[model samples]
Every structure is written in C-alpha cells, then in structure tokens.
Target: QIIEAIESAFGDGPLSGRHVIVTSGPTHEPIDPVRYIANRSSGRQGAEIARALRDLGARVTFVTGPSTTPPPAGVEVVAVETALQMLGAVQGALPADAVICAAAVADWRVANAHADKLKKDPSGRIPTLEFVENPDILATISQMQEDRPRLVVGFAAETSDVLAHARAKRARKGCDWIVANDVSPETGIMGGNENAVLLITADGVEQWPRMEKSEVARRLARRIAEALAE
Candidate 1:
C-alpha cells in the first residue's frame, strides 16, 4: 500500500499509461423542446470515480450528461445531454484500458418530440408521446469483440433484490463487474453523499459497507488498477 501510494503521488502508479473512460450523470430523453425525462442521479459517485482514477495516474475521459456537479481536474470532460449524444461521445473515446458505465442513461427516449414548447390545452387533453428505446451503452461496449476494454464496469441502481438483480445484470450485459447499489427512497443514496454497494464479479459477490461516495470511488479505482496490472 505504501509503495503504491508513493508511486501514485509521483504519477507513476499501476494505472499510469492506462486510459479509462468513465460515463457519469443522467441522460435526458426529450419529450419536447421544453420538457424531458431524466433519472434522479446527481452524478456524485461517477464524478468521484473519475477523480479517483485520475489520482491513480490514468488518462481519464469523463463523459458526462446533464449534471450540476463539476468534473474533477486532470481529466478530459465531454459534456452531453441526451443518451444518443452520450453514446457518441463514449464511442469516440474508445479503445480504453477500462470503461466504467456509471451514467444513469435513460432506457427510452421520445420518438416524436416536438420542436416547439408543448402548450397546455384549456380543455385538459393530455399530449401523447411516442417512445423508443435508447441505446444500451454498457452492453454495446461490453460485447465488443474487436477492441473490448480489458475491464468493463457497470452500475446497477436497484430498489429491491439488489444482489439478485445485479448478478443477473452482470451476466446479461457481459460486463466484467457490476457495482450494485440500493437507491430506494429510504436509503437516500440517489442524491446523497454516502453509498453501500455490492461488487459482483465472476469470483463472487462482495457487499461493501456504507461509506462516503469518495471512499467507494477510491476503493474501486484501486481494484481497477490491480486488475489492469495483472
């Protein structure tokens, strides 16, 4: 640990010369020019993860969605709004050593969003919206055969059966690991500073204790370094 810390301080850590792509924040699916659909993500965890990776001397490509949280220093930031844009950005920054799909990308988008602001009818008639499924960023990168990253990490934000859902997700997405977290309202994790996550890998599932989001990022970053070193 001490040696690794010193190497990291000198910017020659295990992850030096490695490039990692981290997607953070929540992608918005537009319903109209003035309205959109989004998740309850504050981008806190993702930001911290990017920061941690940077501290380990890796070249970080921070692809982010619409969030107020400022990205960390010593990282390249690609700001995007919708899922499609985010997907493009990630693809453009490809061939990385690792990719962390930490963004809460919307599952669907409006297929026929109006160009102008939607007007409210005095007769109280609701406007209908056509929906289309958004691109599965995690699965796309995870299943890539030509230039797949050495490590692919995805996040599963579940309200119930966290581990079961996470394990299934890892297999389904074909990612190297899954970081599962309970974001049920009572947990206060969605927009909070602390988190409790489950690390699901081929070996087994490891449940992490609740702690500050920053600490979780640090631990995950270290693990990624070790994995890459091997």
Candidate 2:
C-alpha cells in the first residue's frame, strides 16, 4: 500500500516527535437550512496530505469541513461546517511544526442567515441576501504571535495568472509557502484526481510537473519532513 511504502522509506518510527495541522474542504455559509454558499473542493487532496504527513512520522490534527472523502487513519480529525468553525478548530490545533491551509475557503459568507427558508410570495417579491467577508484562515494562522508554525503553506486556486496571484497571496498572507494552481473552468482540477501545482517560496517559484494528487502530497510531505528536520 502507499502508506506502507512511505513508512518503509521514511521509517516505521512513530511521529512522537512533532505535531502538524491541516485544513481542508469547503466551508458552507448558510443562507438557511436549505440554502448555502460553498465551493467544489472535495477535501480529497487535503486528506491525502494529512495521510502522507502521518506516514512520514508526523502527528497530524486535521480540521476539515463537510466532505464525502473519509478522514485518513492514524490522525486526529475534527469536523466543522462553517468558515468560523474551521478557523477556530485550526487555531486550537496550532502550536505545530507546520500548518497546511489546503481548504478552498470561501471569501464571503451570508451577512444574515435566515432561521427558516423564506417562502415565495404570490406577489412576486424577490428576497434579498447580504454577504460579508469571511476571515482569512490562512492569513490568521500564519500571523499568529505565540505559536506560529515554523512553516506555513497555503493553497492558491486561481483561474488566470495563477503565479502572479499566488505570489501576491504569499506576501499578503505572510506565509512561508504557497502552492499555486490553475483551476480554470476547463481544468476540471477542482474535483478531479490530477493536479498541476507550483510551489512558491521566498527564494523563488518552483514549477512541478502535473501529477496525481497523491503524488503531489507525497512529494510535498517529504519536503516538509526534511524542512522540519532542519
């Protein structure tokens, strides 16, 4: 199995030494019990990353939103639904060696969520909904004072000028690294198994050949393991 291979290569040693935190899945901003704003991220990539990290000897606390994929074995998993809940969960699991903000978090949420679904009026009146910005979970964790992780990784899912936007996000978020990806409508990378990503760091941007999500997670976990050991 993939896990056995990673353990054999890295060592069967327990991840008794360090802690890691990861976030994944799409946060649902509820307009009501029946309506909500969300994204297409399946949390598959994030789950795989947590599994890979665990395989390479790191204790992982995965905070995730709703997703069909099950949480990986041998890691503490916390489930959350809204953006605020996810943020609180990740912050609570912090003081880690590293944090990966892999969730496709929503930029905005409903300002006022309805307690009950509004019924249609025979008068043909249209109901209005207000939206407000959600907290930037990645930026918040990256800038924490007391327990900031040594390395903070964020994901940039953009359509055009992916690198440019990712670099800007790196500076804006103040994270050590940003994994950039082009998720244009045609890419189908959102819910698909394959991904093409660029690792952006302070030194420079490194382009990685398109690979399976599992492969990306393995390579990335190795890189993080080496970085932590340093």
Candidate 3:
C-alpha cells in the first residue's frame, strides 16, 4: 500500500527518463518434463524493486523466473523459466542505465535430461544424471565491452561467511555492488517478508538492518538514483 501511494504521487522522480532492468525469482532448470532444479525465492524482493523503480519514474524491464508473486504495475514483465531463457530476455532488453541481478539463478543444469519421466527400476537401480554449468549472466554483463549499463548490482545468498563470500563474488563478477544476505533455514529469509543485507561496494561495506522487503527496495532504488546522478 505504501508503494501504491508512492506510485500515485510520483511524477518525474529521481530516476526520471532512465531505463532499468531487474532480474528476479528462481530459474528452473529442467531435469525432465516434470522435475527441475530451483530455489526458495518468492520474487517478492524483485517485484518490490521493480515497483520502486517505477515509482521513481524509471522504465523498468522485469525479467522474472517462475514465481508465485505477481509483477507490480507499470513495468514490462518478461516471464522465463530456465536460466538460458532469462539471459536471452535480459539481453533483449539491453542498453539500460542499470541492471539489478536479483534472481537466484541455478548454477548447474541437467546436461542429459531425459525426454520423458524415467520409470522406477524394479531392481532398485537408480538412474544417473549429468550436470553442467549455466551461463554467468552477471559476469557476462559486467565484463561487456560495449553498451554496458552504468550500474550493475548482484545478490549473494550465502549460508555462512556471508560478507566474505559476497566480497569475493563482487570482485569475481565485477559488478558495481552486491547485496549479501544469509539465507540459512533459521533466518527464514529465503521466502520470507523481511531481509537483512550487507551492501558491498568498491568503496566499502555497509550493513543494513532487517526490514520489510518493500522498504529495502525503496532504499535500494533511492541509492541507485543517487549513484547514477553522480
């Protein structure tokens, strides 16, 4: 509701005339026709981020994975299921001012996925599955030599040593900033309403308090606007 009110009052906000691309949710890599690899992402954060960006008057192209949370108003939503399809959708919406890679994309996919569901073996012989690495969307965009967005933000959902992992990921992926959070089962953040995150940048790291995802989105959008303004 707060976001809705903000949207109504919004006119030529900070991000006016700017283009932003946001990737959200969990990419499903099919293991077969029925089975697939995915995470516990609800896509609430991504939706809120898109809404906040739209509230600021930026044109947002939201590339979302399979998720239950609905996309917010006033944004172009491109629905995709696999990591490869998400990459294609993002590339198609290129030449943006910023790209927020908030999606929890699967790292590996079933290389030799069966065409049909495999029936259970009578002798209890389990079938073996092959795995392959998915494309690194964040690194690809960050290292792009031409038409790269001015700002690229990535998310690191870690179980332990969150800061260290996030810092390493930022250096490795070459993104402008990284939002790291502990998604351990105890934290209940994987599909929860709140998030506690650390913002890691080239300058330094700042710890943000646990808050509703909507508030986090609003804060993040404002920061993005500020960074792009400079």
Q: Which parts of model 1 have CA positions greater than 4 angstroms off?
A: 1-11
The per-candidate count of clashes, in order, stands at 0, 0, 0
- TM for every model, in the order presented, reads 0.95, 0.92, 0.95
Ranking by lDDT: 1, 3, 2
Query: Residues 36-116, candidate 3, lDDT per residue (tens digit)?
Result: 888999999999999999988899999999999999989999999999999899999999999999999988899999899
Q: Report the lDDT tens digits of candidate 1 across residue range 52-154.
A: 9998888999999999889999999999999999999999998899999999999999999999999988999989988999999999999998989999999
Best by lDDT: 1
Q: Write the per-residue lDDT of candidate 2 for residues 105-211, one digit (tens) a residue.
A: 98889998989997798999988888899999989988988768999999999999999999999999999999999988799888899899999988899999989
True-structure lDDT of candidate 3: 0.92
Reference-based lDDT, each prediction: 0.94, 0.88, 0.92
